[model samples]
Target: MGQVREGTTWLSVIWRVCNVFMSLFFALATYVQINDPDAGMWMVGYGVPSVLCALISWKPLVSEHLAWRRVADLHVMISSSVVIMLGWRIHKEQITQIFQQEEGREFFGLLLTSMWLLLCRHSGRSAVGKLRVFTAVAITLFPFITWFYYHVNKELRSEWPSHCKTAI
Candidate 1:
């Protein structure tokens, strides 16, 4: 029992570390998205960590010896995948232009959906619970929040007109 507890604690620490890295990555990506639409390379900074966390978390998640951690790790994996996919889409020239042409409205919508999915994964209940409610609220307000930010950021406004529309 003691050994199991210790292992669980260690896994939890790793999970928390991954979360911290993810938060930083997101912050950096958001800054880049808002300030430097041309700096598509910045997406890799967040993508790499998100993929690494998902991969590292996979081992414990699949181990029969650590069922609880496995479930938690699965959530992390899903979250990471969502982030990676979104990042990839944003970095692609064609997709990125589509997003920019639309004034980031679609991009923000997708981001909100992904975030809500992530929140659902984190929300402790295996089934429906408060987390679901929170996800609902997030999904509902995601577009509005994104639009608000888009309007507030001058860089977003100025760059849209001159950005390339060529599909990747």
Candidate 2:
């Protein structure tokens, strides 16, 4: 029983740390959208998750609030819809390197936000599982690594819209 408690405590710490990282990533995502034509829409898309994740990191129990769940759910629904549309667009365009194009990037941003929100749902009520911690680490790392890859390899972003080139 004591061992289980210790493990849960450790995993909860990891969950909080990962949420902090993800919040920052989403916040950065929101900032970079300043140059986008549809900046406001994209900003809200990323901003909500940024704030929610921040709340979770600050107080894990925030996830248990009805208001928080409703807001997160609404965002998830909207993000999922956008993800489907973006997926179709990517498919139609035959976009193999999704990070290179604007819509491709948008697709990923929304998808990540949606996924993380779903993962966080009801997480405050119990100890975060090992799988959730591992997933949180991956989710926290992916965007930053992908962004760095694009930032370093300018050639990969050669075909990107002018606005997309300015932020990173």
Candidate 3:
């Protein structure tokens, strides 16, 4: 529904600040990655869109209009997927030392930022706001769970099996 129409609120301001901060950080990261001679065009492909989306997200908050908010939501959603794919690619590239790698941080950054934006966007409804908050809290725990699982199943994860294995 359109109940969560764009209107400047504390939540919107917070989300806007978050988006601006993330955009700055991602922009800096992209710059650093681009400077690396070994870094290929793929980083640019992901980085450009990510930074653009992050930057644009602020427009809705600044404009404080329903249409702009919707636009920002759409862009954030797109950027979230892009960053997820980018993060996965980085994680895969570090398969040799996944345990030692911090490659998935970007995905977490994107995900958390997106969650906050979504939460703020829906803050008009108490039920939806609570749900978003709950979802954010739950998702925040995933990294720790993943780390624990990785440590416990390190051996299994190290070897990518090609055949189906019985799970009895």
Candidate 4:
């Protein structure tokens, strides 16, 4: 019992330390994106919410004084959704504009980045829970990713989407 308490206390301290850095990281990202003219509305719009989510989810005082796990889960889900939507909207532009990546490397990086977007979520101890999270993410993201790839293909049908219409 004492050992469990000690370990939990140590983990809480570590979480607090991590919270500080994560808050800073998200804040910086938010500020930079908001100030960047070329980042597009989608990116800039989600920036503030992202920082708020990060700060609220990880702040020890907020967590301790409130329904910590519920709040954390809610914020994490919102932040992850924002990230995935932004990625879906701009994945093509990013893949094309980024530093020289030989051929297939860009898509590989995109896949990895998409997978890593939800690492903050403590997806529970059960395999079913973890699998559910991954499955949900995949289901939500796969369509956009597939659309992106298909649209990018040189031989994709010209009838796919009209240039006059935005993808929404």
Best model number under lDDT:
2
- How many clashes does each candidate structure show, in the order listed? 1, 0, 0, 0
**True lDDT of residue 45, candidate 3:** 32
Misplaced by over 4 Å in model 3 are: 1-8, 38-43, 61-168
In the predicted model 2, the residue pairs found to clash are: none
Best-matching candidate per TM-score? 2
lDDT of 4 by residue, 1-168 (tens): 897777655555444444344444434434444334344543433343345335534653443333545645554555456556545645755655322232232233333323323343442222223344345445435434654675576354343233212332
Q: What's model 2's lDDT at 161? A: 90
Q: After superposition, how far is residue 68 of candidate 1 from its true place, in Å?
A: 22
Give the TM-score of each candidate.
0.31, 0.95, 0.39, 0.38
Clashing pairs in 1: 94-168
Estimate the Cα RMSD of every predicted model relative to the unseen true structure. 14.0, 1.1, 11.1, 12.0
Mark the 10 consecutive residues where model 3 has the least summed lDDT: 159-168
Model 1 Cα displacement at 102 (Å)? Answer: 12
Best first by lDDT, ranked: 2, 3, 1, 4
Candidate 2 residue-pair clash tally? 0
Candidate 2's C-alpha lDDT? 0.93
Candidate 1 stretches greater than 4 Å from native = 36-120, 123-168
**C-alpha RMSD of candidate 1:** 14.0
Quantify all predictions' global Cα lDDT against the true fold.
0.45, 0.93, 0.49, 0.42
For 1-168, candidate 2 gives per-residue lDDT tens digits of 999999999999999999999999999989989999999999999999999999999999999999999999999999999999999999998989877777888898899999999999999988789999999898888888887887888898898899888886
What candidate 4 gets wrong by more than 4 Å, as runs, is 38-61, 64-168
> How much is the lDDT of residue 31 in candidate 3?
58
